[model samples]
Target: MTATMRAVVLREPGPVENLTIEELPVPEPPPGWVRIKVRAFGLNRSELHTRLGLAEGVTFPRVPGIECVGTVDADPSGELVPGQQVAAILGGMGRTFDGGYAEYTVVPRTQIIPFRSDLPWEVLGAVPETLQTAYGSLTVGLDLRAGQSLLIRGGTSALGVVTAVLAKQMGATVLATTRREDRTAALAEIGVDHPIVDTGTVAEQVRRIVPEGVDAALELVGTPTLPDTLAATRVHGTVCFAGMLSNQWIVRDFYPIGYIPTGVRLTGYSGTSGNLPPEVLQDYLDKLADGRIEVPAPTVYALDDIRRAHADMESDQVIGKIVILPISGQR
Candidate 1:
C-alpha cells in the first residue's frame, strides 16, 4: 500500500467548513491492533459535537469517526489475516486518535469484531456503536427480562431503533416516543407496541397505555424528557440514561428524594465499560445474519462529501445511520 491515503480531517474545532480532505500517512498496526482498509465509516451525532467543540477532551486536526467496517490489512500477530472483514467500537477513533474517516485506520484487536460475509459494508459500519450501546444498556445496565415492558425515548434515533428491535426479539413489550407523529408507524413496524407522538402530554399518554407504568425506560434524549420519563416509569422501575442528544449532560436541579417515594431508580449507561462482550456482539451479528434484526442503511456519500453527510445527520433528515464510503462502491 502507498505510504499516504486520503482522509477527512478536522483542522480546527468548528463547523463542517473546517473539515477538509487531505492525504495523510497510512497508519500501521500496533502490537494488539490491526490496520484496516476502511470500506465505510458511520457518521455519529457525537462526531458533529466534537467538531463543534462541544465534546470534551477531543484534540485538533483529528479524523472524526467512532464506528467503522473494513478489512484487515496488517496484523502484527497471527490472530487475524489480511482481507478479513471487521468492525470496531472505541472512543479514540475520530476523537483522540486517527479514525476511520480515512482510507486506512489502526484499531485495537480486542475492539475489532469480525462480520459475516453476508452482511453489507454499510450495515456493518452501522452496527458497532448503536447495537453495542443498546444491548449493553438493556441487558447489563437494566437487566431487562422477558415479558417485561420497555420505554425508549427518541424512538426514531438509530440507537432507539436498535434498542426497540433487540428488546422485542427478547420477548419484551416496547413503547417508544418520537417528536414526529409520522414516524410512529415506521417505529411500530420495527416491533414497538406503543409509539407515542411527542406532544406536551407524552407522559400522560404513556401512563394511559401502561397504567401500572413501564417496567424500564431507555432514555436517549436528556433533560427535555427526564421528567416525563420519571413520571412514566412504574413503581420500582429503572431508567437508563444512555445519551445526551439534547446537549444537557449535567442534571443539577433534581432530587432523587421525589423518585424514592415512587420506588424508582435512575442509572447512567455507557458502552465502554466492557458491558458488551464479544459473545453478545457475536449474538447480534448472528441475528443479523439470520434475518432477525435489520438495521436500515442511511444515505451513502463519498469521502469528498463529508460536509454534506454531517449536514444530513445534524438536520435529522436521514432515517438511519449515515455511511461514508472512502472507496467507490455500490449500496
Candidate 2:
C-alpha cells in the first residue's frame, strides 16, 4: 500500500462542494487500535448535520462518516489481525474525531467487531450503526418483549427499518409510519405490518390497528410526530425516542399527571454504549449470516461519488442504508 491514501475531507462546514478528495499520510494503529483498509462506510443524518454546521463543536476539515466495514491492516494490540474483516459503529466518530470517509482509518480495538464473511461489505457497513441502535433501544432500553406491540415513526429510515425488523424477530407486532406511499410497500417486504401514511390522522390510524393502543412506540420522527406517538401508545407503554428527523419541540400541553395516570414510559436511546455488548451483536450477526434475519443494503456508492451519496441521504431518497465503497468493488 502507498504511504499516502485518498480521503474525502470537509474543508469547512458548508455545502457538498466543500467536500474534496485529497491525499493524506496513512494513519498507523495506536496501542489498542487497528489500522483498517476501509471497504465501505455507511452514511448517517448526523454527517449531513455536521456538514451544514448544525452540529455544534464539530471542527472544520474533518472526515464525516459514522460507520465502516473494513479489513484490518495492522493490529498493534493483537486482539485483531491483518486481513480480518470487521465493522465499526460511531461513538465519537465523525463528531469529536476523524471518521471513516477515507480509504483507511484507525479505530480502537474495543470499538471493532468481527464481521460475518457471509454478508457483503455493503451489508456489513449497514449493520453496525443501525442494527446496534435498534437492538439496544428495543431490547435493552425499552425492555420490549414477545406478544407486545410497537409503533415506529419514520419507519423507512435506516435505523427505523432495522428497529421494525428486529421487533418482528423478537415476536412484537410492529406498526410503522411513512410519508411516502411507495416506501410503505417496501417496508412491508421487510416485516413491518401496519405502514401508515404520515397524515394528520396518524394517531387515529394507529388506534384503529391496536384499539388498546400500541404497547410501545419508537419515536424517530421527533417532535412533529411525538403527539401522535404519545396518543397512540397504551397505558403503561414505553416510548423510545431514537431519532430527531422532524421537529425537536418538547410536549408542554400535556400534564405529568396524565402520563402518570396512564403509566406510560418516555425514554431516549443513543448507541454510544459500546456496540451492543459483543455477545448480543454476535448473535445478531449470526442470524444475519444464516438468513434468520435480513439486513438490507439499499444503496451503494463509490468513494469518489460521496458528495452525491450525502445529497441523496439528505434528500431522503434512499430507502435502507446508503453505503460508500472505498474499494471499487461490486455489492
The number of the candidate with the highest TM-score is 1
**After TM-score superposition, what is the CA distance of residue 313 in candidate 2 from its true location, in Å?**
0.8
What residue runs in model 2 are displaced by over 4 Å at the alpha carbon? Answer: 247-262
* Candidate 2 lDDT tens digits, 1-331: 7999988888788888888888889988778878888888888877888888888778777877777888889987777778988877776677777789988988777778775467777777777788788988897668999999999888899989889989998999999888998788888888888888987548788888899789999988877777678888888898988887753636667677664326777888887637467677677778888888885655988988988998898888888889888876656
What would the TM-score be for candidate 2 when compared with the true structure? 0.93
TM-score of each: 0.94, 0.93
Estimate, for each residue in 1-331, the C-alpha lDDT of model 1 and write its tens digit: 6999999999788778988999888997879888999988888878988888898878887987887888889999878879888887774778888888988999778778776556667767777788788988898778899999999988888888889989998899999988887898888888889999987447688889889889999888887778788788888999888877676667675677863337888887887615567677778878888888766655688988999988877778776678888986645
lDDT of each: 0.82, 0.82
Clashing pairs in 2: 236-263
Clashing pairs in 1: 65-94
Question: What RMSD does model 1 have?
Answer: 1.8
| Model 2 poorest ten-residue lDDT run | 254-263
